[model samples]
Target: MQEWWRSAVIYQVYPRSYQDTTGNGVGDLAGITRRLDHIAALGVDCIWLSPFFASPQADMGYDISDYLSVDPLFGDMADFDALIAGAHEHGLKVIVDQVLSHTSDQHAWFKQSRSSRTNDKADWYVWADPQPDGSPPNNWPSNFGGPAWEFDPQRGQYYLQNFLAAQPDLNFHNPDVADAILETCKFWLDRGLDGFRLDTVNYYFHDQQLRSNPPSQTKQKEILTEVYGMQEHVYNKTRPENLGFLARLRALTDQYDDIMMVGEVGEEGRRSIEIMGEYTAGSARLHMAYSFAMLSDDFSAAHLRDCIEGFQTGAPDGHPYWSFSNHDVVRHVSRWGAHAVSEESMARLTCAMLMSFEGTIGIYQGEELGQTETELVYEELTDPPAIRFWPGVKGRDGCRTPMVWEKHAPNAGFSTSKPWLPVKAPQATRAVDQQGADGIMAHYKEMIAYRKSNPALSRGKTTFITLPEPLLAFTRTAEEQTLTCIFNLSADQHIVSLKTKAKVALGEAVSLEDDKLTLAGNGYAYLSHGAEVPL
Candidate 1:
């Protein structure tokens, strides 16, 4: 039971975008409870709910005004309790998103902290005096834009905010602050919450020295709108002090029965993997961790191999959590469709590929329906990043559209009234009612069943098999079971020569000939080298 999450498939549901039950054009806990059967039908083991805590909608609930209470937009505490009980009755674990890095400016803690220098919680947040020239204490840039420091005239100092001005970073250096946050965590656990998905897990701590980070040495032809991306992020986040906090968090969670914690490592490339390893390297820290490596646009054989191998090399004792689609980035189909023959083929391919990875897996709400990103104009933008830099940077709103349950239903069955974000016609076209016998839906169910039947795919040791471009091959072994997984990541068909032994166990576009394997565009196969196929 303790290792249930190790092989569990977690389905992520964005709070506002999932389903609207109150007809208020926003998703509430009761809405999610109503959709429990839908998630259970998809064969996922658990549901990861996005932030629904009390907020001013300043980052769409990521800025927590009250960690202990659910926002009215998503219903009240009783609704949340009912949601947990509902999910539990349906044999599903509920993982809540805990945004601990910062609190909303309106939060009592922040309000009191920013009230005056002598306030009880004045040092609770990261505040510093203005430089001699009356500028920010450091040169840290916000992830949104401008300086990471916001001038608070009430306190006569600047407070660090890695994100928006409304979200002031917590000063983790204070022991009381960390203990208070953990106490809030205990409040949830005592309420029967299973675990937590720590948001911005690496941003829990900042450099106490208030040093400025140097510019990134690696230059690219393309520029990122997130100014924070241009810097190396040395001083702002991913500090060494974060480890101790994680250990404390783990200690807190260990008090509960079979509780799991997954940290979101927001760093990029191998560095993220390194942090992922460190965060989950032992039982004293995180249970597992995920990074942007698999979420980025670099979908290649080498890229996948390097990410897996990097984690294995860095922290051999660590477990990993992989997800190709979440609330943050663009949907995988929208981002990588160009490489496939069609969107459907790409969807099936990604599902098969991700399910085969030797780690816990997460699938976003509409990913099972092969949802694509919605196209929005300037007037329709809700996400701050999209509003700030239009045209050049299309922000996360495209991927956060409401889930379409019925093709003919008004607003695609998301709500009786208009939903928060407009649902695109293309996304609505793949609604659940219309997809009763749809191939992609069938494929997802079948793939999930296959993964559950085969222990090797979920709890195996992955060994990369060298092959030419676009042909990603790896062997996963567990006990006496060994399976060969192969995928053609591009639109072009490929034929590979296979020596020794293996048979196509699960998938389409897989043809076994006289020691030759043929795969069409976006094709994948799980080959069983064991005595017999388990399912």
Candidate 2:
């Protein structure tokens, strides 16, 4: 059977923002089920739901307290089953976010592990003795802030805390810990789950020696103001031992039919691509992987070419998943607005570009409406970074605001009561009900249909075509089909002389006459490269 995920497009639903049915101001599983038609209408093959598992809400639902149970805030187990059934009925595969890297401090396992050194679960978490000077074991910095270790008076030792203090990293080196995590994953798969979007997949293991990371050679900072960007991060994460656990995960998923796992590589630049290659290079590891490469602020053709070519050279056998927006980052339409004619045009351009790429695609909620980030004051912020560092950092709350379903309804129809995160005017203006036939939503549906209709665009090998600074071009070939994709990644129009005569397959603001093509700002086109034209 053909693997469903290779050519699939995934729609991500942030449960807290998708829809709220109980009027408690938070979205639930029933709300997702209620909105199944909206997702199915997009013509996507699958839906990836963000974490709705049991948690203390410390780091949202990422700090999973119980992997096996549904969070009461989202609904009960019956609600989850109904959602799964509803999605399947819509002909959409359901894949949930699996955060196995860490657990909340309130988790029963963490409580037992931290209580005493002799307990059965004592070694379940990474624990280390402080230096004789009463300091942390090493010089590792947390991804959030401060040291990566937290003091525990009861154990007289520090535990590794990769993110917030409430989240403790698990010890994957222990066989039992690995077994238990795999079993949790199996529980979900057994319940008719299509697969998982493994959160921070490269962070599963750390160096057994607990060595301090060296200073970064490239000094490539994810967040320049943060201390975590200063180190090369060879020890704390992206460890070689992570591959073993990934193989184990693959073995478990392999037991089920047509199950797929796509990992989220939490690295930057070429290193991120390299890790993506390693993690998905073989059938024994991740089926596919994605990184933050395309999610950055760099929107130039040169940057886009470099990322695609770098991945093609590094991981020829591995498959990649690409996305421009998600729960954690700024919306791409706003991030790349400087290079576009307008928000709607930019959204249409990206929809065309991402659809023509060579692997699986992920679309976040509200992206179909060309949604921009919501502006918020410090008083309305709920994200940790924004709360901790007020004016200096605008946390993820801007992107995590409630999704808008209605144009003029209260809270933009996301919830009946006040939402967990407020929905402002800018976002509410682009509600689903507001989109017309020629709007961004229609453009998305059109491009998705175009991609599915062309086999070369969906399942073909990519070859970059050299073009001018503001123009990016590539060819995708499979079997007897070939397509040339060209894009003008600037806010200025340019006309280029085509080397050969080819008819336009799908695109906007470009025509072929006397071997010439004109592309307006942010305009893109797919040209038939061979004699066999795609209908």
Candidate 3:
């Protein structure tokens, strides 16, 4: 098999927010097909569509109602096929998201399961009896808010819901459920899709015992989003049974040539990296797995080193997929701007740093334009988290705004009519067309090209070098190729001395003098071996 995904940079497209051709206040699959050339021009190898499956839109398209059908909001089967064919025509692979862990309350399977206990599909979704007091089965909390289990009068029991109550978790404990989902994968594979971005891959199987999660030692008072971090999450998710399920998924994908799978392991810090390792540890699992570790506010050199090293230690043979921002979180430029010289400088720096890492790369849309988080008022909110806890947790709505393509076009060129999500001035100012002359957009193209042109960056062993504060440095060594990469993680100019003679392989916004590299705030560089630092 080609293993083309090993080093390919995957670009994620949030379909409802990408582009709108229907003028129905939303983006559809046809919109994506129309913009295929834009994605190809970005130099990415693949496009990972968020979720266009038949959904009720409770959590955007994450709450799927039908595994094989595209939601009417995003177009139908014909539009999806056109997207796949068009992407391939542009030399870009297509990786659609698979939300197998759960489905919308309106799904036929869930509906059938809730109607009666004796039905053949009754056990298809996770269901349990409430305690004598009529409370939820256990202490499991939903990622959105409130109890993770919802009481259902129809079945006289509580159903498990890790996210919105509208999105019920599937009962992977059922062999029939596993078989059904696998068949769903076959449906897409038969449609000629290249790969899958497995949504909540680690959340597929919960502990059979349904143990209560213990409270964390650290109090979570930051925002509503951080409340879930207070639990140990020992049983509700990250189960061992998931490994077996992943193997089945891998085996199915192997049946098709060059097909790949990258799981989204939703965890933080150590546990996140460990799961990424375990999921991609062998040939019978995912090709790569990404965690929320890199999607956090941690920008220190030590933190970056620990995240990568943690994965390496957990599974020596495992591969990783790294990203700074996605549809689920704030844009990295805005999230990390507190320590940056400026959004433009920091955005470019993050791009270079991400490419230099020893794994595959995933870029969310609008990031290359140095886009910031849009400030949405209470009325503009659609994401569940923000709705429940307003000012405390802004939710993901700000990040899910429509992509700004034109400077003066109606609706910022995202749609001819009003967009499903509003496109505010702050975000629209960083429009794709407006940034073409200079700035982060141009830098991203250069950085991605640089990473692709150099084999060492995409397919090399990475070694982190200990340096003083604010300077993250590492070297990538592959067969007959070697390159050193350095980044300034702070908004203060600092210079560091390099022990080895380095040739300027690729650099800007920094200078070298007699082995001393001077990096302005947010500057970065890539250098090759055997050349003296410029004097």
Candidate 4:
């Protein structure tokens, strides 16, 4: 039987800002349990929780110190069990973020490895000796900033960290490390987790020779950071050995029934989609993978078409997951500024476009509420990237603000006390309570139900319709149904000329008219032919 994730819509929840029941200014498992009803109402098949494992908080929860246990700040094992049970009771699957590519400096394995060169766990992490001049071993730079290699005087060598220096990259070259990580994953799978969102899945391996990365002749685009992506990032990550490790992960997941794994490919440009293809090429590897290609500032129809078509060509048989927004980057509405007509229009159109794709869909929390990006001042900044490279880059804190439950409540009902990140008034206005009638939230729920009700939209084969710029048109066909989805990805009115004859279903319900299909700025319409096209 096909797995649940094949056509599922997974909602991502950033735990730190979800809801704080303990009044600790941080969201916990108990808080998540209390809010299960809200997620269930969104009609998502699964919930992808950002890292809640024990960490030093250098990179928030991404720098995991312990993978097998839950952090005290989030909750204990019992709380996790309760959350999972509540999610299941509400007919929702649970998927947690697993940072296997790296570990906190405080982790037992890393601590032991850093103590001495001859320790049993010494090779558990990527470590290399400095050159004769005491310089770092390679030209590879960390994703955060500076050199990827950090000096460890105790071992008289340098350790590699794709991210922050405090979070050291694991050496998958060591079979023991791979075994240990697999054991950690099995622990959760046995405990009833539906699956995992593999963090930095492509950064699992590095060059064995620790060679220097060659510089790219291309000019750097400072979208997120200045440290990484300045060069081609050849030898730093996406190594061939990573594929073998992914196969190992897939094998571990296969041991359990109905479990799945989605990897986060952090490569640059179209390379991310290609890596997603490679990682999920076979049944013995990742079940699905997603990249930052669609999560960028680009909102042009041509860009979207090119991205999907590129993936289709690269991984003809490989499964891919499509998402425009997540916890890592700016929200799509604000990122694509001029293209966004109104929050309501963009929210509906974005969901319509995502559901029409031929892959699994991921929707970030508060997206259903039509939440916009929250502006934060320098003093309120918590993200390291924003703090270090202020002004040039606005950082991710804008997109990581707390969820809004009640407009009148303190901290927008996220917590009684102040949140880790402030929830702005504009975001508060779009609270769940406020979206009670004819609101964006209601529209989202309706769209989700509509997609679920129509098999053609849920699990149909997609074929792109060649259209002009700012207008995206595609047809999704199943055995007995054919649905045409059209979107105007701009702030100006656009028209889609249909050369063939077809009746529009759900016309009155969704404001879509007959043969002449007219779309307002950032508008979208779902049209269906009574009969499916013969394959």
RMSD of each: 2.3, 2.2, 1.9, 2.3
lDDT tens string, model 2, 1-535? Answer: 5699999999999999999999999999999999999999999999999999999998889999999999999999999999999999999999999999999998999999999999999999999999999999999988888899999999999999898999999999999999999999999999899999999998989989999999988746466458777889999999989999999999998899999999999988778888888999968999999999999989988888787777787888888999999999999999898998988889999999999999999999999999998889989988887788778788899888999999799999999899999989999999999999999999999999888888898898888877787988888988978999989888889887776678888888676776778888888888885522121
lDDT of 4 by residue, 149-184 (tens): 899988999999887889999998898999999999
Q: Encode model 3's per-residue lDDT on 1-535: one tens digit a residue.
A: 7799989999999999998888998988999999888889889999999999888899998999999898888889999989999999999999999999999999999999999999999999999999999998899988888889999999999999999999999999999999999999999999999989999999999987888999976656665345687799889998889999999999999999999899999887888998898999979999999999998988899899899999989979988899999999999999999988888888888999998998899999998888899888999899888988888888998888999998788889999887877888878788987886567788888889988888889798987777877788877988978888888899998887876667677876899877888888998889887432212
Which ranges in model 2 have alpha carbons more than 4 Å from their true place? 220-224, 529-535
The lowest-lDDT stretch of 10 consecutive residues in candidate 4 is: 506-515
Error of 4 at 36 (Å): 0.7
Instruction: Provide the clash count, candidate 3.
Output: 0
Please state the error at residue 288 of candidate 2 in Å.
Answer: 0.4
Clashing residue pairs found in predicted model 2: none
Q: Tell me the lDDT of model 2 at 7.
A: 97
lDDT of every predicted structure (CA atoms)? 0.89, 0.90, 0.89, 0.85
Query: Model 3 — which ten-residue stretch has the worst lDDT?
Result: 526-535
TM-score of 2: 0.97
Q: What is the lDDT of candidate 3?
A: 0.89
Please, what's the RMSD in Å of model 1?
Answer: 2.3
Collision count for each candidate, in order: 0, 0, 0, 0
**Clash total of candidate 2:** 0
Residue 475 in model 2: shift from native, Å? 0.8
Q: List the residue pairs that clash in candidate 4.
A: none
